[model samples]
Each structure stands twice: as C-alpha cells, then as structure tokens.
Target: MIWLVIILLLLSILLYLLLVPIIVVIDTINNTYYLELKGLAKASVIEDNIEVLKIKMRILFFKFYMYPLKKMAIKKSKKTKVLKPKNERFINSKNLKRVLRVIKSFNIKKFYMNLDTGDYAANAKLYPVFSFLNFYKATNCNVNFVGENNVQLIIQNRPVRIIKSFINL
Candidate 1:
C-alpha cells in the first residue's frame, strides 16, 4: 500500500544517486580544485589567505567551510612508544596494478596543460614528448619557451562503475 510506494520511491532515488557521476575538476590556471557530485554537492579548495587554504563544501542551499591548515594549541603530554603490527600488508606490484586499473576507469572530460621549464634546452627536449602524448591522448600538452605553467583537467566516474571496479579487484 502506502508503505510499498514509499519504499519503491526511496529505491529509485538510491539507484539514481548511484548512477550519477562524480566529477573532479582541477584548474591550476585559476587555482581551483573541486569535487562535484552532480546536482547534489560540491567541495572545493579555496585560499583563505596567502599561506592558508580551506575546504568549502556546498550541498543544495547550505554551504560550509573547513580550515584544515589552521593551527591548534597543543598541551605537553607524555610520549608513548608505538609498536608495529605483525600482520601489516604492504602494497605490492599486483595491488598497485589493481589500484591503477580502478583509476583508469574514470573518463577524462577535458585535459589541457602548458609547461615551461625555464631552460630552453629542457623545453626543446620536452617538445617531442609533449607532441607524442598529444597525438595519442585526448589532451592538449604543450611545452612553452615563455614563463607559463597552466593546467586544467576534468574527470568523472559513476559510483556504480567504481564499485564494480572494486568488486573485480
């Protein structure tokens, strides 16, 4: 009856959310880095001052700011010795490959970069490498002689896809 209808509605909403893609945008040209869950929430890093950076999150009509770099007062306390666990697992080559595969699942929406190494010889050496990458990938990679370094990248992946990747691993 009414309960069944409500449950169905909630399930549909959950499915929609899982299907929605999460986007990551990085723009060094504007010094903006943000993660966006389409139509739901956005979190961005912003500079509070010359040396301080803060995270700003916006969900619908509400906005919040978090200062991760803010200094906190520390009180003197006794130091305790920490012991390492015996069953600790290190990331071997196999696990590293799996992690890389998961990252490769993300779709690149846009990619552009302009790099300057300050040395003319280095720039000359990098020009061929940049040209080769640009030809193979959907990216605008450039080596500039002038003093300019800029990058803008936008990538997205659905939650379901990420979950599927993890499951495969």
Candidate 2:
C-alpha cells in the first residue's frame, strides 16, 4: 500500500544517484580542478593564501572549506596509538588488469595536452602520436619544441560502473 509506494520512491532515487555520472575536470593552464556530482555536490581546490591551499566543497546550499594541512597536524597531535591493519594490496599482472578495467570505465569527455621534451628530436617523435589523437573530437593533443607544458582533461564515470568493477573482483 503506502509503504510499498514509499519504498519504490526511495529505490528510484537511489538508482538515479548510482547511475548519474560524476565528472572530474582538471585544467593546469587555467589552474582549475574540481569534482562534481551534477547538481548535488562539488569540491574544488582553491587558494586563499599565497602559501596554503584549501579544498572548498559545496553541497546543496552549504559551503565548506577544508584545510588539508590543519587536519594532518591535528591527527599528529593525538597520542592514540591505533594499529592499522596491514594492507594486502600488491601490484601484480592480475591486479594491474583490474585497475586498468576500472580506469577504462571512465569516459573521456575532453582531453587536451601540449608537451615539450626540450630536445627537438624527442618532440618530433611524440608529435605524430599526439597528432593521431587529434582525430577524435574529444581530444586536442599537440607537442611543442618551445619548452611549454600544459594539460587539460575531463573524464566522467558512474558509481555503478565503479562498483561493478570491484564487485567482479
């Protein structure tokens, strides 16, 4: 009856959240980097001081600033000696394949990079590799011999795909 309707509504909302794509945008030239979940939440690196940079997160109408170094300092001040469990993760061919699958799930929405290797011969060799990627509308890659480096990448993936990747493991 009413309970069934409410449960269905909740399940639909959960599915929407799990299926919605999370976007990660990074642009070194303009110094913009952020992770966004459509209209729900966004976290971006922002610098208020010349030396210290903080992460600013916005959820709904609320804004929060997180200082990374301050939290680490507070953790160091605590005297609690908690034994952490030994990490069992190791790099192997099998584990590497799993990691590759997880990375492949992400869709490259946009990618642009300009690289210079300082040596003209090295730059000439890499030019064709980057030029080949330029055939795709989503990518704009090039190599310069003028010693300038720039990168901009935008990728999106759904939580469900990430969960599935691990669940299969």
Over 1-169, each residue of candidate 2 has an lDDT whose tens digit, in order, gives 9999999999999998998889999999999999999888999998767438889999989999888766443345557788989787668788897898899889998888999889999988988787777775658888987788999999999999998887786
**Top TM-score prediction, candidate number:** 1
| Clash count of each predicted structure | 0, 0
Best model number under lDDT: 1
Worst ten in a row by lDDT for model 1: 80-89
lDDT (C-alpha, whole model) for all candidates: 0.92, 0.88
Which stretch of 10 consecutive residues in model 2 shows the poorest summed lDDT? 69-78
Give the clash count for model 2. Answer: 0
- TM-score of each model, in listed order: 0.88, 0.79
Q: For candidate 1, what's the RMSD?
A: 2.2
What is the Cα-based TM-score of model 2?
Answer: 0.79
Off by over 4 Å in 1: 73-81, 85-87
